[model samples]
Target chain A: MKYPQGVKRNQVNTPRADKEINYGQRGMTLEKDLDKTNQFYLDTKRAIIHKKPTPVQIVNVDYPSRKKAKITEAYFKVPSTSDYNGLYKGRYIDFEAKETRNKTRFPFINIHAHQVEHMRACHNQGGIVFIIVKFTVHDEVYLYPFEHFVKHWDAYLGNGRKSITYADIKAESILLPIKYNPRYDYLAAVDEFYFE
Target chain B: MKYPQGVKRNQVNTPRADKEINYGQRGMTLEKDLDKTNQFYLDTKRAIIHKKPTPVQIVNVDYPSRKKAKITEAYFKVPSTSDYNGLYKGRYIDFEAKETRNKTRFPFINIHAHQVEHMRACHNQGGIVFIIVKFTVHDEVYLYPFEHFVKHWDAYLGNGRKSITYADIKAESILLPIKYNPRYDYLAAVDEFYFE
Candidate 1:
């Protein structure tokens, strides 16, 4: 299985590999699926959502021509907010997506403190905030609202529980439909939960 | 005058140099001022605006330790949307900021076609979209709404006008206040125009 260039397959667990190992699914990663879904949403004029690009700090650039500038040296910078955000039904929609191979729990370590603070701030500003957790082992996806996630986050800080159990997530979150074309139809869940 | 590393001061007009030349203002660039304004907005719990980090395509990364990962090679990528966006008073706010050395007009060439398309899409989704145009030579900043900007943009395409005249901008747009703490206080315009 050939991976994309610059993708460190050994350092991070590749979603393609995880899909094949756990669910015998071939092709299409969670990230790729979500991108496709967002594109589809845009094309259909249903909603406007985008994944923010990975931040980079540039150290050097070479101007080979008047019109062309090429970066010679750079480094990736940690993102301060969620991966996805946009407008839906005149409301701000912001979310972070993550997948875990573990069947029983979604680990707290998967999310950064700044991301949590960002989510809280967005929510306070009357934006709709949520997290999409994919349990690759179970081949399931859950949309967990920021309001509920914050409670668990605060509880963890108080009690030292490092994860949210699958049971708790299933009880608290709305199940998102996985389908062709749009791939991950998470916005359907958004429509149902947020709009309704 | 030394410019920041990786920034080609010769290729494009630097805002700092423009400030020094035009207004004898020595310390702040439009970018820094907007960043401070966004931070002030966040701290005051007034809005949840953020400047999206510059995108980068990472090529190589080195993990010196189990927890430390360093990117060895990368290149900057063009962004698909506006720079700053978030929720303000339950409304989705999206915008791009640019500064020009020209005294009489704001060049249409300064903005990319993709950014115009992005602003149009956000506007279609009922989001409040605008551009912060700073005529550095005149030391004036205007908050130009996307609705009006699109008309001029379309007219440019139709009649080959390459710029929006300073007089037109002053007449059609809201002049944003330049202050000490928040710097470019554009959100005050948003509150007045969008909310009021």
Candidate 2:
């Protein structure tokens, strides 16, 4: 498994060392890592964030029993908002996380237009809105604040580049810390960049 | 259909007179009215609140083509958080909406324990948290602030009353005004009770 650069394996806490090794062996995905990180936050009472459920439009359902109502037909719906949102330290936090296998750039097509508009609205209303992009090929994750993200998005709307280059993201975004307990310590980046 | 007491039909504005008449004829539900209210808020750029999609646990899905992924088997999930949440005037707003046919009281069975805990967490974090209770028989809707709701919840936890009395709710909660454009003007109550 790929590890973030400059972090020695021995630096991890001894109690969670075995789990870290197991996580690496399993090849962690961005979604799985965020789930672990959010769970850790909840356990420690640090945040109340949660991943919103997958949006689905149910067409038919079957009631086999009093307690068992099974969805027989459904289709995924385009999400109108970010995947994760909650209150963090008295501030509203909202963000979308996406992973790309493309090594050179993060494409704009990964996010929906409605979601971008929603984030913009939230940001204007003083929410801490951001995007977490994971370049799987490089085993790196970066948090791009809404202010920076919208600049690129508006540029794209004006017939600019279709994607944000890897170099651009590396320079503009906050590189998240990887840890044993939380897996992806993105909130640490939040604390430094936003709350600070 | 039942209308809230002491309001003449002529009191509603003429611009939406036909629509309001149709809404009454069709039987307006709390969920439908809130959808209209939230949509109105969004259209006017007043707020970005949304009712979360119903949570479902998918057991099996089939891909018919590259474009269509059909969910074949799924089940409803007990929600762990409130139904609605968003940013309002820079503060996080979160609430659960419930409807009861009983005219005398609002029962605790309508809400799950996990949702209560989530609301408590948000409230403690300085978020504007509340509960919207619609008494169908009385055609009345009330917004109970988290602070007031928790008192009864704690009492129930201590083997006290299992439900909040309607008269107590009337005395403690804000009665939401039903209107033509927004349907239920709950945020007006928010503006008065919290922001004022």
Candidate 3:
């Protein structure tokens, strides 16, 4: 396996293709490493954060043994939402983690409608809600609150911009410090956003 | 498709296949419908509720097209905590939804230590915590508060019973009414549990 640079072996998929293949976007490198960091966080119990399961609409399974079954006829399930969430500190934390290698901007299409809605609801209910976006080229990560994202999302229909330029992200979002333990010390930022 | 006479279609996979099911262990069904119902509520502006996505550790994928890919290799990623969670009536709701077919009891094995710990943390934070389980044959659904379930869960680990008996569920749980719009009126039960 082509171990993606700086990823531990135990991570579910820490390897990249032998050669660079297009992911239709840039900077999957950031996505990989951050996931690795999150996995590390989960392993040590430094924090209890996890990416949601891949949605699969199981159609059939072939049980070779009574206890073992191979899902052979299952189809990909279309998710109605984003991919990551969990709890940190004493609050119910919900957010989606995405990365864009594009040095200029992060596409709004990367964020789904249901995800924004979920974030909005959680935010309205006073839960900690935000998104962690990694800009691979800049080697930077920002914790963008769902409030701003949703504001732009609701305005997307009337406005023409479909994404936030790197400049805008830097201006409106909290640039979280990358840490060794939690990797995404996001809750700290939330505290900053909450208390200070 | 057959509307599983024994178990509702939305509540598929009601625990083990070999045994008769109970009515008080229908958490799986309750979780799925609540997710949809929560979305319906969000869309209709009633309340914002959500069932968190399943936690997964994706290992491999088969990209069919530039825009589409199928997961070729993956595993049932270990989840670190509860499954269904959302905000309801300005309260944070966190829970693990599970169903058991065991005729006499709901197995403790159906839940993980992390989930129990998660519920504990949420409850300590003043977030409303509980679990939904359905007993199929009895066609009854019960909402077990986290406070109660955790006690039973730990007792089971300390050489007590392997599962919670039906009588215990009936006594300590709230029986949720079946509603056509949401299927399971868990919020109503939460109202009684938290407010009344």
Residues A1-196, model 3: lDDT tens digits: 5666544654554435522343434455555555776677555554445566667765455566665444543446666655665555555667788887688988887676766776776787777788889886676889898877777777786887798788988988999776665566766787788657
lDDT of 3 by residue, B1-196 (tens): 6674755653566444533343333534656676676766777665555565544444566666665566554445557768776666655677777777666798888777777887776677677889888777777778899888888888877977888898889899999888887777777788898889
| Preferred candidate (DockQ higher): 1 or 2 | 2
What is the docking quality class of candidate 1? acceptable
Alpha-carbon lDDT of model 3: 0.70
Listed in order, each prediction's TM-score against the native is 0.86, 0.86, 0.76
Q: Model 1, stretches more than 4 Å misplaced?
A: A1-28, A65-67, B1-28, B64-67
TM-score of chain B of 2: 0.85
Output the lDDT of residue B80, model 1.
84
Two-way TM-score contest, 1 vs 3, winner: 1
lDDT of each: 0.85, 0.88, 0.70
Count backbone overlaps in model 1.
0
lDDT string, candidate 2, B8-104, tens digits: 5446534466665654543457888899999998888888899999999999999987768999999999998999999899999999999887779
lDDT of 1: 0.85
DockQ for every model, please: 0.47, 0.71, 0.24
Tell me each candidate's i-RMS in Å. Answer: 1.9, 0.7, 3.4
